[model samples]
Target: MADPLSVSANVAGLIGLANEVGKIPVNYASNVKSAHEDAHCLQKELTALCHVLEQMRSLLREEKLQGTRFEETAALVSVLGFTNHQVNELYKKLDKLSIQANKNKLADFWERIRWPLKKDECDKAMEEMRRLAQYFQFSLTAANRLDFLSQTK
Candidate 1:
């Protein structure tokens, strides 16, 4: 098995890519291009890392040796924390975004609504906006729903 710190370090690197993506100026053509390329690269790397993590998790689950301490495993799990509440909130947000995306997909919606928009440009803008809105809504809904559940309990 790989050192716990190595797994943590890789996770940190993946997070760093997310931070960098947040900082990129999406309004500028060149910046958008750069951000897209960076995002694609990060996605590839993170997917590979996810496979590695899954394998490690499976190994940990399969091992049933007597007297095998679980403190390290517990600590590792803590480091990779995302509670059930958080996941539930995320799902809600995704649902909302999916609705918004459907709305944006209507033909001539942007032209009839927003100003100074070509059909192609409007479609592109709406597509990107819908994607981002859904992503954010998912995160927000997940967090809020989890919070609500906790409060109720």
Candidate 2:
């Protein structure tokens, strides 16, 4: 949210992270099947988040000046920054599991696969993603309304 270009880049980075979530290996051991399921749920949530972030990016692009509604624009930026941080943390947590799995594969074929996140952790992350997306969606809708009102004026 520092600049329009940076905002777009941050959104793109988030989308990229969401896409990477899909690439996570899900063929986990039977003992950790729940975690594997959690990964799928997380992937789905991230996909939804990606769509929401894309809509946000479009809104930012359309309202380059952010118009005369300075307070709303500033609030949107704050939410965006917070959302970015949360998603990045989620990605890093998942990435740690993926990295460990890869390293273990080289050590032994029979090594037990373990997911880094518990069900509650994944659920928390997904909930946060949904909440952030909803906020962004609301902000985008409000911005669109403001834009229409200004044009009509």
Candidate 3:
């Protein structure tokens, strides 16, 4: 990668974007403006992901820092890569669900859901939440591991 620090920064940005995207009521995007906005945000997140991929490719190009020797880095990159893919998939699903949602029903349900923990009623929303949680899980694991690994060096 460009550097471990750069990769970590990009991943942190990705996580923040994913967190925001997860909270958006994509399924309730009943208008062109909302969907368009969500799409724009997603595009920005994808651009960040692309930057991370480029950094990884740069790392691979380094003959002195051959990828095989950096086992922990490789593992972290792999997990982060998967998390990135999952984030994209979740975004697409959310947008599609939002477009297909009954906004009136969703609005009423969301209002009530806010008062209660009845998130299961909205399958798509639940899925987004689940993926968001997974992202956090991965981020924490990597953060802890990175900290420990860096300290040893």
Candidate 4:
């Protein structure tokens, strides 16, 4: 497995990014259709990350990293702390945001608020987001190879 700490930080980052993508207000949206598409992509990525977290937690319980480098472990600790902060901040922002669909009982309200205007711009942004996520995954996997090699010694 990859350095769980590095993956954890990126997972946190992905959480924040996914939250932002998921909550893009209707007034701020470029294209409603693309927003929906992005939401689907983000949802899938979040689900995968959740599984990764669970796996890492399970493995750590079964195999203690007694031989791991201290510096790497320290970095992971820092990432976990920062991830904690990121989650809290996201919750606070979500709490403060009002959803009019609740009182209006309007099904369409959600659709409106979710997708704004400027369709092309929205597509581009979504594409960039996907690329960034892929980059993080690639890096984590590469690092994991190193981690796996170390374990053999």
The candidate scoring highest on TM-score is 2
Q: Residue 62 of model 3: what lDDT? A: 48
Candidate 1 lDDT tens digits, 58-145: 4334423223444535644443443222323323322231233334566433322222323464344335434433443454466468
lDDT digits (tens) for residues 67-118 of candidate 3: 3333445656666666667666666545443333365977755443232222
Which is the leading candidate under lDDT?
2
Each candidate: what lDDT? Answer: 0.38, 0.68, 0.50, 0.47
TM-score of each: 0.31, 0.73, 0.38, 0.41
Q: Who is ahead in lDDT, 2 or 4? A: 2
Q: Write the per-residue lDDT of candidate 2 for residues 93-146, one digit (tens) a residue.
A: 766554444456654333445677877887898898888878878877887899
Q: Tell me how far the alpha carbon of residue 56 in candidate 1 is from the true structure, in angstroms, after superposition.
A: 1.0
Cα deviation of 136, candidate 4, in Å: 8.9
The parts of candidate 3 lying over 4 Å away from their true place are 26-73, 97-153
- State in Å the error of residue 95, model 3: 1.4
Candidate 3 positional error at 138, Å: 8.3
